[model samples]
Target: MELAIADKITQKPAIKRNVYENVTQQFNKASDLMDLDPDIRKILATTTNEIIVHFPAIMDNGRIEMFTGYRVQHNNVLGPYKGGLRYHPAVDIDEVRALATWMTWKCAIAGIPFGGAKGGIAFDPSKHSFGEMERITRRFTYALNGNIGPEYDIPAPDVNTNSQIMAWILDTYLSSVTPQERNRSIHIVTGKPIASGGSQGRDKATGQGTVFCIEQWAKDKNFDLNNATYMIQGFGNVGSWAAKLLKPFGSKLVAVEDHTGAISNPEGIDPDKLAIYVKERKGVHGYPAAEPVDHESFFKTKADIFIPAALENQITAETAPLLNVKLVAEGANGPTDIEGDGILQEKNIDLLPDILCNGGGVIVSYFEWLQNKRSESWELEEVDERLRKKVINAYKKVKNTSQEFNTDWRTGAYIVALSSIQEVYRTRGIFP
Candidate 1:
């Protein structure tokens, strides 16, 4: 459970707080600082609903295996539930809860008209065939049934999941619902394939969002993007995009790593070539052009910025002090634990909070939803322009809040998001 782990991160004074709980605690601390109402605070701290589903799927070996899945709707006060669906062995209810909660705040902070929800299946997708994965996803979709809809909850792809998974979800839903209902409800999911109404830029939204924020950070600090050195962890969609986008700005990408291994070139590795290589061969090991670096040494490299574009808890108390960078742009959700956060803050390191830093994907996904609902698509240039403005404005809001409250970026983001959510809740009022 991500939220449980985040909570654990804050429980023991000396022990490292769990990543998700640490994130929630940071929001709680900010709310307290803001003197937020107790009732509203409680509502924000807990999820509204959590659904766990147990379903049997026939494996590739003709054996029926039970798989557990979770879908947690953190809140819908702002709008419909919005979040990604991950397929991984480590997924659990608690993690979904935390991620969903984060989604609520992330959308609020980004000023998107959406709430927060997260769902995930508990199994390693790598071990499954494409057909098997599709079957599992369709079954999970069937279980969700009425719980997810175009106007209620929308799911995207996350960790070990992709557009194909979303395609299966859409197809399953479309087949289950009546034609009339389907026409009016196709916008339910945000990350479907292009043929299925997914937006053009959705693929690179997260990494692009990371770039927009980082570039804004650079400008505000009078730092040149071309002069910056980078060490990125995880070569997934987010990491790969960040690396590729930074090239034009003259970034000397010194290192990159995935689940398999890592590689480095102080002079900067060509992201395009590396990406193609990874696609063809899988993973970043033996890139041929760049020398292999021990996985641990990957993060230890001296650089201008360290981007943790991977999974949670990668930068904990144990690894926080080992970081040799000046800034940390969290490309993944809850990458830094509370202790690690404290270490970074004490060290005066600049951290682009995940809620704000990696929100571009969802923001664009919202655009995709709008396009789907209206049956309209925007040009890439238009989408890019709008995305830049939205991300930059959001960054400035968070930066201003940080200065106003004299707090770190994470708490500042929480303060802004909480105030917005509180106002919405107050205006909407409670139901009978």
Candidate 2:
């Protein structure tokens, strides 16, 4: 049955081109190509719920500050909603909606039994002290109340949020439930500290996953990663870990750019040294190992691969044309906008799309959840092996889909994800 409401809901375009629009545009393209059912398209296109809460937190100076937070549950046809919670001033509804939507596709592509959801507070965590941050996290968790649970929505770390913040959430959430539920509710959130039930290899999961995909690509292209030059856009967890893991593969980090500054070492900067430098300096600036480079020069520098592990839209149409690399492995969500994607496609740059490229975090999060639920702790070697297998499988599926559709990797990933969702909907039918 054709529903007018579904058509209207899916057809209406946003007034401005933003992250949500970018995701929707990609989704619509894949849906059209696959000839997806209209009803399912509508269901997948719209969010299941959008929760916005304003709460007060006591700051260090004894002043109460108001903070706004959002949690957008995109879909759960596959399973429970799962995603990360970011703490940044740019954490608005649109960005959260887009990220949640991507999480839906990301999980489906990875064949994980989890839907998509994302939440965030519109405050900069760097500006707050430890006590203030804890209070804010607890307050946000309290505000969520029954909206999040072990068997329902699960949030991990993203952007400014980390395992410490997740611990606060886990503790706060556990406190709200009954005694019997408290012990079993540790699975309420993933990415907690290892001492608190986090997986052994969870810290480097995202980077390792990206490396796995790259390894697969290298094999297919008969390209060698040994001594290959690469540049990274961010120096955070994902970028740093990716560089560190790739180091053993003989890949050299030639250039790096972060919020602090950009640096380049033509002979290749040592990933271990650069990582420590970033940790101490809070960014790549003043590393003393590499010469400083401007934003333009960073992208224009010659290299074999480019990893944009930073924020969204870092690679736009303007910047895409300047890239001299042969492949782009996105470690960040929505790093390339629609225009930027087009530019890369035009340039024939092989891309490991964000959904497949950066899926390791969630994949390991699944392991963490499983371990917590089963009262088991996996070793680092076991966790790494399992993650490798899962990520490589996802990469092969996406690559095959791209070949079948004669399209780019990004759209191919969406097609694979959407097809999975469509099949579920077709088999189960709609609820009354």
RMSD of each: 3.5, 3.2
Point out where model 1 deviates above 4 Å.
1-18, 54-68, 123-135, 295-297
- For residues 248-319, could you state the per-residue lDDT of candidate 2 as single tens digits? 989989999999989999999999999888888899988897899999999999999999998899899889
Question: Which residue window of length 10 is worst by lDDT in model 2?
Answer: 2-11
lDDT of 1 at 186: 78
Alpha carbon deviation, residue 308, candidate 2 (Å) = 1.5
Maximum-TM-score candidate: 2
Task: Give each model's whole-structure lDDT.
Answer: 0.86, 0.90
**lDDT for model 1, on a 0 to 1 scale?**
0.86
TM-score of each: 0.89, 0.90
